[model samples]
Target: MDPVRTGGLRVVRAAVVLCVRAAPGTVALSFVMMFVGGVTPVGLAWSTKLLLDGITAGDPAGRNAGVAGLVVLGVLTALLSHVRRYCDQELSRRVKVRTQIELFTAVSAYQGLAEIEDSAFHDRLRIARDASEFAPVQIMSSLLTLASSVITLAGFGYTLLRASPWLAGLVLLSALPTLRAQIRLARRHGEMIVRASPFWRRQAFYAALLLDPRAAKEIRLFGLAGNLRTRMAREIHAGQAEERAQDRETLRVDLGLAAMTSVLSGAALAYLAARIAAGHGTAGDLVVLIAALAATQTALTSAVLDVATTGELITTFGHYIDLTSRARPQPRPVAELAALTGEIAFHDVWFRYAPGQEWVLRGLDLVIPRGRSVALVGENGAGKSTIVKLLCGFYAPVRGRITWDGVDLADIEPLELRRRIRATFQDFMTYELSAADNIEVGDIGGGRGRADLAAAADWAGIGETLAGLPRGYDTLLSRTFSDSAGDGGHEPTPGVVLSGGQWQRLALARAVLRTSADLLILDEPSSGLDVRAEHEIHRRLSELRRGRTSLLISHRLNTVRDADTIVVLRDGVVAERGDHAALMAAGGVYAGLFRLQAAGFADETVPR
Candidate 1:
């Protein structure tokens, strides 16, 4: 067997196993019904022949018996069809749910961001998700249908062979070309879908942009709906072009196969007519020959179709198997992370986003001593975020190592290491949940009550605003959803959206809610606040930082002037490290940036 065919068989087997495990009773019942359904048509054909012969011979009892048998079989077949349909739908639903859950679970288990950040992986993921939705069930259904068709073909073939072996052989042989054509078409269809996925993804992106509330404001402001619509249409056209070409090829091949079968049927009919004209065949023989010839062709065609459809479905489902089967990197033998008693140190760390990319951090060495606040100030693209990601263990160093106290970060369990750290990122999430729920999300497993949530909100300077909402802490914080569940039979109100600064404050409350965290990191924590609000929030943060190990990254020099140690990052290395006054005296990059920002605030012009 061909390697591709062998792989397809394996996928088919896996699909069978998955469906059986998902709903074994449904699978067994469906197959049993299919078998009965397959044999019913054969029974109907034989009964029609018996009825015709009984009428011709004036046998009234025989004709009546044939009529009764036909009626019973017809009703049974109809009932079986309905039951089979229900079973197929139930099996499909169960399998879809199982596959989707397993798919996402595997996705979430990925221990690194490298694969998640990959563009090609995104395409594969999208395809795999689509395959998960239907492929397994479709493959199983097709396989069962193929088996049913085979049973039908065997019965019809026996009838035809009894009438004339030559006719039966010719009818069976005609299906070979169709079977070959359908296999080719299936392969082409699978390839076309893979080729067109990128276009479909882009089309989906444009479609989503048109519907997104965030983009709606900018789109209307810039008058961009027409341009976006045009781009979306272009992607649709690109993808459809591939499909249309394949469809045309499929049509041509089908027409040729149809013509061949039609010619064979005509020849068989003429031969049967000559046998009857020569007085060598009875009226019943004529009826049986006509029915069996047509039935055999139909059964063979149906069988070929089921096989083709199964092949196509298996080809697509292979993507899901490939994605889920990929082995995750095993963790090295390491102990649980210990408390941060001494310092977090980066020793000669070097990193790049990918191979051949420009290095983001080059031979960088830094440290945050225990119970001391360290503020990292840098210009944009000075690797501030990269360092944060590295420290959070989202990525590892390309060459050097980071350590907790003296133990290498790579030697500590990732989950255990992260549980001791808390950070309010510059790009923190603003969840569309209740105000209290948003804060609670930060330390979900911490089991804190509403009072603890309120305290954290107060620490972030957002307690009063949240408390003033109509439903207090339970109020939904988004305009996207309405509070439709009424209280006391009264009409409910809609939720409200917060301002940027308010959302920022809420995110801060979320991070601060994790009071047990050992190392606190604040990245531009007051960037969205007004002047007075920023001043007030920074004062609270300064107090929060007192006698605690913290790392702060801020572009505002005034905010870090009172830190225990301020580190200036320039060219991916520490340019200066000391107290604010010491760095200002040194008058290096940090001093120049501070004076420049001060000039802007003092209403004095500064040369570029």
Candidate 2:
């Protein structure tokens, strides 16, 4: 078998299995309905022929029986049509729900950012999402249609063959070209969609920018609306151009095939008319011949369409299969991971985001012992964030290893390793949820009560602020849903949006909620605060980090002055490490940077 055909068969098998598992009862009933519906047209044609013959012979009983059969079959056909539609809709809904769950689970359950950040991966993901919505359902529908068409074609073919063997052979042979053309067109359309995905993705990005609240101010201030709109329009036109070209080709091919079928049908009708004129056939035979020819053509056309459509859908669905079948990071066999009680050591570790790229960490060696605070100060792109990512097991070292106590990080399961650590990045998220949910998401599924949330908020110095909101902790923490109403008798009330400092405090509270975490990582925790807020937040942080195993990253030298040890990084390596006072006394990179920052606040009028 050809590879493409084999792959399509695999897709069909998988889709059938998925549909059956989603709604087995509905699927079985739908197949039964389709089988009955397929033969109804043949029965109607035969009844009409019987009525015509009986009318010519003056047979009253035969005419009445034919009329009754026609009435019963017509009504059954109508009812079955509607019932089958209902079954198909229900089956589609169930499959959509199941496939969507599986799709996102495969995406979210991945342990690293490497694939998620790749552009090619995102294209596949977008295609997979589209497949998730309709691919499996469509495959099942096309299969059912094909099955139904086969029955219709067989019944009509036999009738036509009995009436005139030559006409039956000609009609069946004429359908071969139509099937080949449809499959060829389907392959072209599938390829076009794959090529157009990047354009569609780019268009989605620009469209999102137009609606994003964060970009609204800058867009207006810079007069960027027109430029962004033009870019979005360009991408849309690019994708549509390909579709229009495909449509033109399809129209041309279909028109040519329709003309050929018309000519063949006309010739077949002439032959039958000549035979009847020769006294070899009756008016009843003419009616049956005409009906059989049309019915056979319709059934063959439908079967061809079903096969072509299934082929196209399977191509799109291949992306979903690829993503879901990808090899995920296997979990280590450790039943339970031990708490990080001793120390974490990074030994001669080297890493880069990609091969052949500049190394972000070059043979870097560091350690953080238990019950002590370590502060890392570095310039931009000096690998401060990279270290945090490596520590969290988001990526692995290209050379060397990181160990928790005596065990290598590579040996520990990523999820289990991360469970022992809590981190607050400089670019933390401000989730649009209720105040309580915003904080509680830190230790998700921990079942912590409101008291615990409030306590964590107090530790981050945001307890009073959250409690003072319109509905206290229950109040929404976003202006986006200000117009949305609450449950019960509560009417719409404007929700509040936190200021930068307040949002930062809320984020800290979130990190604080994970109190059971063994190692704490805080990256620029007070970067968004004002002078007074920063001072107050650091005061709270001092109490929080005291005698705790914590690694802090900050640019403000004054804030890290009280840390147990300060490490200054330059050129992907630790340049200096000591107490703040000792580093200042040494007059190295840390001392120079601290003096430059402190110089801005010097009292020129009094002290100078």
Candidate 3:
């Protein structure tokens, strides 16, 4: 009941199913090829003895017959080898394709994007990815070689036994040392792969930046190609040096073992020759015995190698299973989000990132009524964004009661909760998607049609920017984005690039499209925009603020001075609470920060 034994049986069963389904002829041909290939070496070894005996006895006809048989067997061996290799390659290619398709589906189904960010998981995933994508062909080739080698060695062993039991013993001993050393090295190399996969992934990324066409402009403009190349070269050299050092040690051990095996086999051959000279054995018998010994070594060494490769292949193949298990989709319950009410409340919340950390939100209590705009003005490090993320259901507070219309957030599915909220982050992703698609992505799977796209664009001041696109709303954003819009048979084009401000507006537009959402959040939406653009955005935001509950996180106090409430955050704790006038009179954390800002615009004499 070992798990590996159970899984291996399953894998083998699946492989057999595929093999039988693909080509029944090829499967049968494998056994035929193994048998035919095995007979050739045995035939040649036996014929050598006959040829030598006929020559020694001065029989020209018998010698010619033996020579003719050896020639025929050699031809047969070549043809069988070719047929076996051809069939194995074809079968493996098909299996590889099937494996890759399944891997894609399994990995794509993963909902936990956070797991993909972990180093250990990434390393394991790379191994699975390679095995699913490329290992089928290798496993197939190894299996074929293993089959042919075993059959040939068994046939050769019989001939060796007929000549002398000592010859067969020598053949077995000769391959043991080589097989032991090679197998150890192969296993060690596999271990190295486990350790080196992550490093290699990083190196590959840097190398891609150096070589890829899309990265060429950035590389040249930033003068990063040489630096990246040097960094990657260092990693490659370090890995290669370690492997080479191991290889050198392995080589020394292997050579010493090989030398000892050769001496033992050579001594056995000398004994057989001496027997032939003493008339205990004929010259033909000695010749046949040596040939049989050589064939046995070839086949036995191959079999041992095949076994080692198969072990490594299976070990790596298990990674695919592990990755699949981790990525298994959870069957979450469906909840009604269509008839949502926008009441949100956070009560007595105490939060921390992990068990041992200090609490970020201690006894936090807040509420945003069915439809209203609230502002959280905080100094850096005040847990303002954490509050926004909590509302958006990206993360749950370690200890808190967040209610959606009197229903605790814990009772609702995370995805379903997110569907009722929309937000633009300070560090929002500038996806390499078309201008229109950028907005459409906010309500992804909703398929809200072209009118939704235009509405969102207008709300966020992106319509003016979209008008300047190369294809209006259909120019490819990223250089790597292929011109496949036409091939999709939808629009003439459906991609467009945008500037930084334009991208920010597009992100805003994306948030705007989630019109059905009860709650909306915007974190530092106008941070780096020009003065005119910032004011325009603030003006546009006023229209959006009506009749919808929102939480705005901003350092620009002027924009949120008109909020229903303004809570000051300093050092992850609330320091003050009041409107612009009330906070100015209180003269606490908010008062100091506001005075600092207002003084920047004061005249030199007037400030004092």
| Candidate 2 C-alpha error for residue 341, in Å | 2.5
Better of 1 and 2 by TM-score: 2
Under the 3 Å rule for N, CA and C atoms, how many clashes does model 1 have? 0
Per-candidate local distance difference test: 0.87, 0.88, 0.74
Write candidate 3's Cα lDDT for 1-608 as tens digits.
11123365454455455555656677777767766766677788777777887898999987998898888887887777688778877777666677777777787665434455467767777887887654545565567678777877787688677767866776787777677777787667667766677777778878877877657878899998789989998878877776787778778876897687677768877877887788877777777777766777768767877777766666676677656555665644447554346567888887776579777788788777777788898777678987886776556767778888888876676677788888888988777777677778899988788887888888788786685776666656765555466654655543444677877888888888888887889899888677898999988786687667888889988888877778887656567776778988988888888888878877466545
Top-down lDDT ranking: 2, 1, 3
Q: Score candidate 1 by lDDT.
A: 0.87
Error of 1 at 531 (Å): 1.1
**Could you estimate the TM-score for every candidate?**
0.94, 0.96, 0.79
Task: Give the Cα RMSD of candidate 1.
Answer: 3.1
Question: Across residues 323-387, which tens digit of lDDT does each residue of candidate 2 receive?
Answer: 77664557686646787779999999999999999999989999999889999998999999999
What order do you get sorting by TM-score, best first? 2, 1, 3
The regions of model 2 sitting more than 4 angstroms off are: 1-6, 327-329, 482-485, 492-494, 603-608
Best by lDDT: 2
Clashing pairs in 3: 474-495, 475-495, 475-496
